[model samples]
Target: MITFDQVTVRYEDTAEPVLRGVDLTVEEGELCLVVGHTGVGKSTLLGAVNGLVPHFTGGTLYGRVVVDGRDTADHPPRELADVVGVVGQDPLDGFVTDTVEEELAYSMEQLAVPPATMRKRVEETLDLLGLADLRHRALHELSGGQQQRVAIGSVLTAHPRVLVLDEPTSALDPTAAEEVLAAVTRLVHDLGVTVLLAEHRLERVVQYADRVIHLPGDGRVVSGTPAEVFRSSSIAPPIVELGRAVGWSPLPLSIRDARRAAAPLRAALSAAVPPPVRPVPGGDRPELLTARGVTVAYQGVPAVREVDLTLHGGEVTALMGRNGSGKSSLLWALQGSGPRKAGTVAVSSDGPKSKDPRKLSAAQARQLVGLVPQTPTDLLYLESVAQELDQADTESGVAADGVRARTILDRLAPGIPDTTHPRDLSEGQKLALVLAVQLTAAPRVLLLDEPTRGLDYRAKSELVRIVDGLAAEGRAVVISTHDVEFVARAADRVVVMAEGDVVADGPTTEVIVASPVFAPQTAKILSPLPYLTVAQVAATLPADETDPDS
Candidate 1:
C-alpha cells in the first residue's frame, strides 16, 4: 500500500541527507515495523507516508512516495487524510478536543462524516482500544498512557486504509501497550489495514510485525523478515540477543518461543546461582529524602493519596505501575514543583534537621531535589544545545560557562552537536540534555519520569551507566517508567504503585519477578530462574558453549 521509490530527504543547511536512496514497499494489510537507533530518520520515513516530510516539515524530497494509489507529492496531508492516518510521539500535541469521546470524533467531523456514522465508529474504536471506561474523561486529566490510547483511537476512528504510528506504545504501561498492539494486529489481520509503525521498544512490537525495515544511521535502508534482519542487525530485543548468546537454531522473537527453546539452557543453569541482588541500603546509608502523607488532587479528584516514601543515598529506585496510577503526580510532589494537597517532603542537607522542600525557594528546592520530567523538552527553550547548557550552568550557579552542564551531558550521551537546535535532537538526546541540566544543580536526590520513552537498548545502556555512576557518587535516584526491561537492568529497588497508593516496595528482583505484568522478558522466558536480564542469563552460561552466529 505504501511505496517509496528512491526516496532521499534533506533539509536546508545540512551536510548530509537524513534519508538517502530509501526504496521500500509496504504491502497492503501488512504490519511493517521500522527499526533503528536514535536520530536515524525513522520519523522522517514515517512522515513521508502522510506527506508531512516535504510538505509541512520544509524538507526536500528527491523521489516519490505513493500511498494507496495516491502520490504524497501531488496530494497534501489534507487531501490524503481519507487514506492515511498518522499518530505522533506526543499525543497531547495532536489533541484538539477536551474529552476522549470528543477527540475520537473530531477527525470524522473534519471529514464531514455523518453524525450517526461518526458515533458508531467512535463506539467501535473505544471498545477496540479498551477505552470505553475513559470515554468521558477529559484529555488533560488522563495519564500519558491514556492520552496515547486516545490519540490512536482518534486516528483509528477515521478508518483510513493506511495507518502510520510513531511510538504508539511509548507512553503505555505493559497491559495498555499489549491492548493497543493487539488492536493494531486485529486491524491488519481482520480488517486488512496497512500499518507502518516506528517504535524504539522493539520487545513489545517485534513479535507482531509482519516485516521489518532496518534503518542504519548511515542513511541506508535494509528490509527483510524479522529473523533475516535481526540475524545481523546491531539493534535487537533481549529475546533475540538471548537467542544469539545461547546458539539457538532460530532466534526466538516472542517469550513463548524463547521459553520453549530455553528448556536445556534452563536445565544447565538450574544448579548455577544467578548474580547477587543489589542489597537495599538500610540505616547504614543516610536517608536523603523523606515524604509523609503526600496527597495530590485535581479539581476534587485525588491522583496521589496520603503516600509515605523514603529515599536513601547510593541507591536507584524504579517507580512502576499501570496508567493513571499517580506515578507522575508522586514524582512531581517529591520534586516539590507539582501540587501536594497534604504532604511534607523533607530533604536532608548539610544541617541535621530535615527541611521541607515545598517551603524552600525554587533554587533551594532544585538544589535539594532535581527532576527531569516525562517531557524533557518542556525544560528546554534555548536556540541551541550550547546555549541550553550555558543557561543551565548559570541557573544552577555553576561558575564555568558550559563546564558543569556540558560535562554531565558528555558523560550521559556523547557526540551531540553543539550547534543543533534542541527541538531537532532525537528523543534520547533531548532526554540526556535535560538530565544534564538537572544534574548541574547536584541535588542529593534525582527523579526521572518515563526516561526510557524513546531510548533504544544502546541508549538505555548508557543511561544505566549514568544512573549507576550517580548512585555510586552517593546520590539517590528514582526512575518512574513503564519499561519493565529497563527496570530489570537499572533499578536496585522496585516500588509499585496502584490507584495513587504504594502497594509493593522491595528489592528489584523480589518486586518484579513475582508480578506477571511488570516482569521483564528475560525473567518471563527463564521462569523458575531468578534472572532478570539477558546479561544475567549469559553470565551463567558455560564458557565452552559457542554461538552459531559467531
Candidate 2:
C-alpha cells in the first residue's frame, strides 16, 4: 500500500541527506515498525508517506513515494488526506477542537463526510480507543496520555487506508498503551488498514510488528523480519536482549516466547539470590522535604486530593500510575510552582524552623526543590545551548561562571555542541539540557515528570546513571513516569497513585512484582523471581553459562 522508490531526502544547507536511497514497500494490512536511534530520520520517513517531507517541511525528494496508488509528490497532504492519516509525537499540537468528541469529528467534517456517518464513526472510534468516558472533556484538561488517545482517535475516525503514527504510545500508561496497540492491531487485521508506526519504546510494540525497518543513522535502511533485524541490530528490546544473553536460538520477540525458552535459566536462578534493594541510610535518613494536606483543583474539579508525603536524603522514589491518575498534579503541587489549593510544602535545614517554599520567591523555591516537567523544552528559552547554560547560572545565582551547569550537562549527555539551538536538539539532549538547568540550583529535592517519554535505551541508561549519582550525593530524587521498564531499572522505591489519591507505596520490587499491570517484561518472564531488570538477571548467572552461543 505504501512504496518508496530510491527516495533521497535532503534539506537546504546540509551536505548529507537524512534518508538516502531508501527503497521499501509496505504491504496492505501489515503493521510495519520503524526503529532507530534519535534523529535518524524516522520522522522524515514517516512524513514522506503523505508528502509532508518535501511539500510542507521544505526538503528535496529525489525519488517517488506512492501511497494507495497516489503519488505523494503529485498530491499534497490535503489532497491525500482521504487515504493517509498521520499522528505526530505531541498530540496537543494537532488538536483544533476543544473537546474530545469534537476533535474526533473534525477530520470527517473536513473531508466532507455526512453528519450521520461522521457521528457513527466518532462513536466507534471513541469506543475503540477507550475514550467514551472522556468524550465531553476539554482537550486542555485531559492528561498527556488522554490527549494522545484523542489525537489518534481523531485520525482513526477518518478511516484512512494508511495510518502513520509517530511514538503513538509514548505518553500512555501500561494498560492504556496496551489498549491503543490492540486497537491498532485490530485495524490491521480486522479492517485491512496499513499501519506504519515509529516508536522509541520497542518493548511495548516489537512483539506486534509484522516487519521491522531499521535506520542505522548512516542514511541507510535495513528491512527484515523482527528476528532477522534484531540479530545484528545495536538497539533491541529487553526481551530480545535477554534471549541473546541466554543463547536462545531464534531470539524471542515476546515475553511469552522468552518464558518458554527460560525454564532452564529460571531453574538455575531458583536458588540464587537477586541483588539486594538499595538500603535506607542508617541513623534516620535526613528529611529533605515534607508536604502536608496537598490539594490541587481545576475549575472546581479536584485533580489531586489532600496528600501527605516526605522525601529523604539519598533516596530515589518513582511516582507511577495510569493516565489522569493525579501523578502530574501531585508533582506540580509538591514543587511549589503548580497550583496548590491547600497544602504546605517545607524544606528542612539546620535552622530552627523549616522553610515554606511556596512563600519564597521563584529563585528561592528552586534552591530548595526543582522540577523538570514532562516537556523539558518548556524550561528552555534561550536561542543556543551555551546561552541557556549561561542563563541558568545567572538565574540560579551560581557564581562559578556557568561551570556547574555545563558540568551537569556534559555528565548527563556529553558532546552537545555549544552553538546548537536548544530547539534543534534531540528529545534526549533537550531533556539533559533542562535537567542541567534544574540541577544547577542544587535543590535538595529533584523531581522529574515523565523523563523517559522519548528517550531510547542508551539515553535512559545515561539518565539512570545521573539519577544514581544524585542519590549518592545525598540528594532526594523523584521520577514520575509510566515506563515500567525504566522504573524497574532506576527507581529505589515505587509509589503508585490513582484518582487523586495514593493507592500503593513500597519497595520497587515488592510493588511492581505483585501488580500485573506494572511488572517489567523480565519480571513477567521469570515469575516467582525477584529480578526487575535483565541486568539483574545477568548478574546472577555466570558469564560462560549465560551465553552458550559465545
Candidate 3:
C-alpha cells in the first residue's frame, strides 16, 4: 500500500535531513506501529506515505515514495485523497467543518463520491467510530477525544485504502484511546484498509499491532513483530517488564497474555517479590496551599461553585475528570489565568505573585505558576533546543544560580539534539522541550496541563521521574492529566474533579485503587496490591528480602 525507497527529506532551512535514506513499505491491510524516541523522525516517516513530507512540508526529497501505485513525489496530498487518509495529533487543527456530520461528509464530497453513497458511508463511519450519538453536535462542543474520533471518521469517509495517523491517541484519555484504537483495528480487519500510525502510548497500542517499526534517534528503522521489537527497545510497556523477568522468548504484547504467562511464575517468584517503597522518612513537610471558597463562571455559567481545595508544598497532586468537568477551569483559577470571585488562593508567604519563581514565589503570577500548556510547543519561540533552555533558565532565575540546561534537556529527552531547531523536531520532542523549559522555573507549585499527552513510553517514564524528583525536592507539583497511569505513578495524591467540584482526593493508592474510573495497568495486574511501579511489584517477591539460607 505504501513504499519509501532510499527516501530522505530535508527542510529548506535545515541542513540535515529529517528522514534519511528510509526504505520502508506497508503492505495492504497491515497495521504498522511506528515507535521511536522523540525527534527520531517518526512523523516524517508517516508524512512520506501521504506526500506531506515534500508537498505541504516543502522538504527536499532524495528518493521515491510510492503510495498504492502512484509515486508520492509526483502526486500531492490532494491527488492521493482517495488513496490515503490522515488523522493528525491535533484534531482541532485538522477540522474543516463546524458539525460532526458535516465534517465527515466534507471529505467524501471533496472526493466526489455519489451523494447517496457518501451519505451511507458517512453514516456507517459515524457508527463504526462511535460518533453516531455525536453526529449532530458542534465540533467545538465535543471533547478532545470526541473531536479526534470525528477526525478519524472524516478521514474514513474518503474510503481510502490506507490510513495514516500521527499520534492519534496522544490527546485522548485511556478509555477514549482504547475506543479509537479498537475502531482502527476493526477497519483493518473488516475493511482491509492498511494503517501506518505513529504513536507515543505504546502500552495501549503495541499489543494490537501486526508489525512494530522502531525508529532510533540516530535514524534507523528496526522492524519486527511487536514483542520482538519492544523486547529489544529502550522503551517498553509493563507487560514487557514481566516478559523480561520470567524469560519469555517472545515477550508478551498485552496484559492478558502476560497474565497467562505469570500464573505459573507467580508461585515461582513469590519469594523474590519485594515490598513497595515507602515515602522518604522524616523531612520538612510543607504546609498546604489552599484555595478557599472559590467560585468561578464562564459565559455566565457557573463552572466552579464555592470550591475549596488545598495543594501541599512538596507533593505532586493530580486533578482529573471527564471533558467539560472543570479540570482546566480549576487549574486556570489556581494559576490566576482565569476569572474567579470570592476566593483566596494563598501561596508561599502570602506575597504578591512573582514575575518569576524557581519555587513558591507569590510576587509574580506568570512566573510563580509555570504552566506547560496543553499545546506544549505553542509556547516555544526559541531558535534551537539549547537556546530554548537558556531562555527558560534566564526567565526563571535558574541561569544565574546555574541549572545546566543540557542536563535537564538530556534527562527529559536525551535523544534530542541541542543544536537542532525546535520546530523541526517531532511533536513529542517539542512537548518534551517545552516541559524542560517549564521545569526551569523550578516553580514550587508547578502546574502542567496534560504533560504526558504526546510522550512515548520512555518519555512518559522520564516525566514520571522528573515529577517525582520535584516533589522529593520539596516543590509542590500539580498536574491536570487524563492519563490514569501517570497519575498513579507520579502523583503522591489525587484530586478528581467533576462538574467543577472536587469528587475525590486522597493518597494516590486510595484514589486510583478505589475509583472504578482510574485503574492503571500495574494496579490492575497487582490489583490486591495497588503497586504503581515495577520496583513496587518486585518488592513483593519474598526472595528479594528473605535470607538465601532460608
Candidate 4:
C-alpha cells in the first residue's frame, strides 16, 4: 500500500537531507510503526506518504513515494485525500467543525459522497470510535482523548484506503490510550485498512504493531521484525531494556512476555534493597506553595472541587488521573492563571495574600508559579527559537544575554536549530523550547502538564535529569503525566485525582505500587519488590549478574 524508492528529502537552508536513500514497502492491511529520536525525520517520512512533504512543506524530493499505486510526486495532499488519511499529534489544531457529528461528516461532504452514504458512514464512524455519546457535543467540550477519537473518525468517515497517524496516544491516559489502540486494531483486523504511523510511546503501541521501522539519528533506517529492529536500536521501551539487562534471548516486546522470563531476576533482587529516595525536606522546610478550597468551574459545572494541596521546597510530585478528571484545571488554578470559581492559592514568600490569587497581575502570578501547558507551543509566540530564548532571558532579569536560557534548552533537547521557527519544530522540540522559556524565570513552583507527550526514550532520560536537577536545587516540581515509567523514576510523591477530588496521595512507592493501573512495567514484572524503575532494579542486582552476554 505504501512504497518509498530511494527517497531523500532535503529542506531549504539545511546542509543534509532529513531522509537519505530510504527504500521500504508497507503491504496492504499491515501496521508499520516508525520509531526515531526527536527531530530525526519521522515526520518527514510520514508526510511523504501523502505528498505533504515536498508538495505542501517546501522541500526537495529525489525519489518516488507511492501510495495505492499513485506516485505522490505528482499528487498533492488534497488530490490524494481520498486515498490517504493523516491525523497529526495535535487534534485540536486540525478540527474544522464545532460538533463531533458535523466534523465526521465534513470530509465525506468534501469528497462529494451521496448524502445518504455520508450519513451512514458518519454514524458507523461514531460507533466505531466509541464517540456515539459525544456526537452532539461541541468539539471544544470534549477532553483531549475524546477530541483525538473525533479527529480520527472525521478522516475515517471518508473511507480512505490507508490511515496515517502521528503520536495518537501521547496525550491520553492509560485507559484512553488503550481504547484508541483497540479501535485502530479493529480497523486493521476487521476492515483490512493499512496503517503507517509514528509514536514515541512505544510501550503503549509496540505489541500491536506488525512491523517496526527504526530510524537512527543518522540517515539510516532499519526495517524488520520488532525484535530484530530493537536489538540494536538506541530507543526502546522498559520491557525491551529489561530483557537486555537480564540477557533474555528473543527480547520481549510486551509486559506479559517479560514477566514470564523475569522469574530469576525477580528472585535475585527479592532480597536486595533499592537506594532510599531523597527526603522532600519537610521538618524545617517551609511550604513553598499551598491551595485551599480550590474549585474550578466551566459553564457552572465544577471541574475541580474544593481541594487542599501542599508542595514543599524540595520534592517531585506526580499528578496523575484519567483524562478530563480535572488534572489540567487544577494545575492552572494553582498557578493563579486558569478560572477558579472559588479557591485560595498562594506562595508563602509572597507574604500572605489577603486578596484572591486570581486577582494578581500576570507578571506577579508568573513569578510565584510557572506552568508548561499540555500544548507547549501555546507559550511561544516569537518567530524563531533564538528570538524566543532571547526574549525569555531578558524578561527573566537574569542579566544573561540568552546564555543561560540557551544552555537549558541545549541540555533538554540538544542541537535544536536557532533559526528554526517555534512552530516548525517537532512536538518534542517544541516542548523543550517552552520548558526552557519557563525555567528561565525560575518560579518557586514549577508545574509541567504532560511534559513527555512526544519525547523519545533518550529525550525522556534528558528530561528526567532536568527534573531531578531542579528538585535537587530546592525547587518544587509537579508533573502531570500518564507515563507510569517516567513517574516511577522522576516523582518523589504521587497524587491521584478522580472526578475533581484527590483520590490518593502519598509517597511514590506507597501510592503507585499499591494500585494496579498506576504501577509501572518494572513494578509489575518484579511484583512485591517495592521497585518502580528499571534503574532501581538494576541497582539492587550485583553488577556481575546482569550481563547482556550471559
The models' CA-based lDDT, in order, is: 0.89, 0.88, 0.76, 0.86
- For all predicted structures, in order, the TM-scores are 0.96, 0.95, 0.88, 0.96
**Which candidate should be chosen as best, given lDDT against the real structure?**
1
Models, CA RMSD each: 1.8, 2.0, 4.1, 1.9
**Per-residue CA lDDT of candidate 2, range 1-550, in tens?**
9999999999774668999999999999999999987767888999999999889988799999999899998999999999999998888779999999999999999999999999899999999999999999999989999999999999999999999999999999999999999999999999999999999899999999999999988888999999999988979988988887888889998888888998999999999998754444445568888988999999988888888888988889999999999999989888777899997888885578889877889877787788999878889898899999988888888874534788888866776778888987766678889988987876889999998887778777877877887888789999999999999988888999998888899889999999999999899999988888888777889888777542
Model 4 over residues 284-336: C-alpha lDDT tens digits?
55678888999999998889999899998778999999988999999999887
Between candidates 2 and 3, the TM-score winner: 2
Model 3 spans > 4 angstroms off? 10-21, 130-142, 268-274, 277-284, 300-306, 341-344, 350-363, 382-387, 404-406, 415-421, 515-517, 539-550
List clash counts for every candidate, in order.
0, 0, 25, 0
Local accuracy of candidate 3 as per-residue lDDT tens digits, 1-550: 7888988788776657777787887889999999887767788888888888778877688989998899987899989988999988788879888999999999988878999999899889887877888889899877666787888889988888999998888777666778889989998999899999888777778888999988876666788888777777866676676566546666777667766666655555444534533364247776536778888886687778778887666688888876667776677777776677657676664455422122334436655566777777678897898899878777777745566556776876776767888877766777888888878777667889888877777777778888878887777888888888677677778888777788888888888887656767666665555466665655565454332321
Which regions in candidate 2 have their CA more than 4 angstroms from the true location?
Answer: 13-15, 277-284, 349-351, 397-420, 424-429, 548-550
Give one digit per residue, the lDDT tens place, for model 1 in 426-497: 777888899889878778999999988888788788788878878887899999999999999999999999
lDDT of 1: 0.89
Q: How does model 3 score by TM-score? A: 0.88
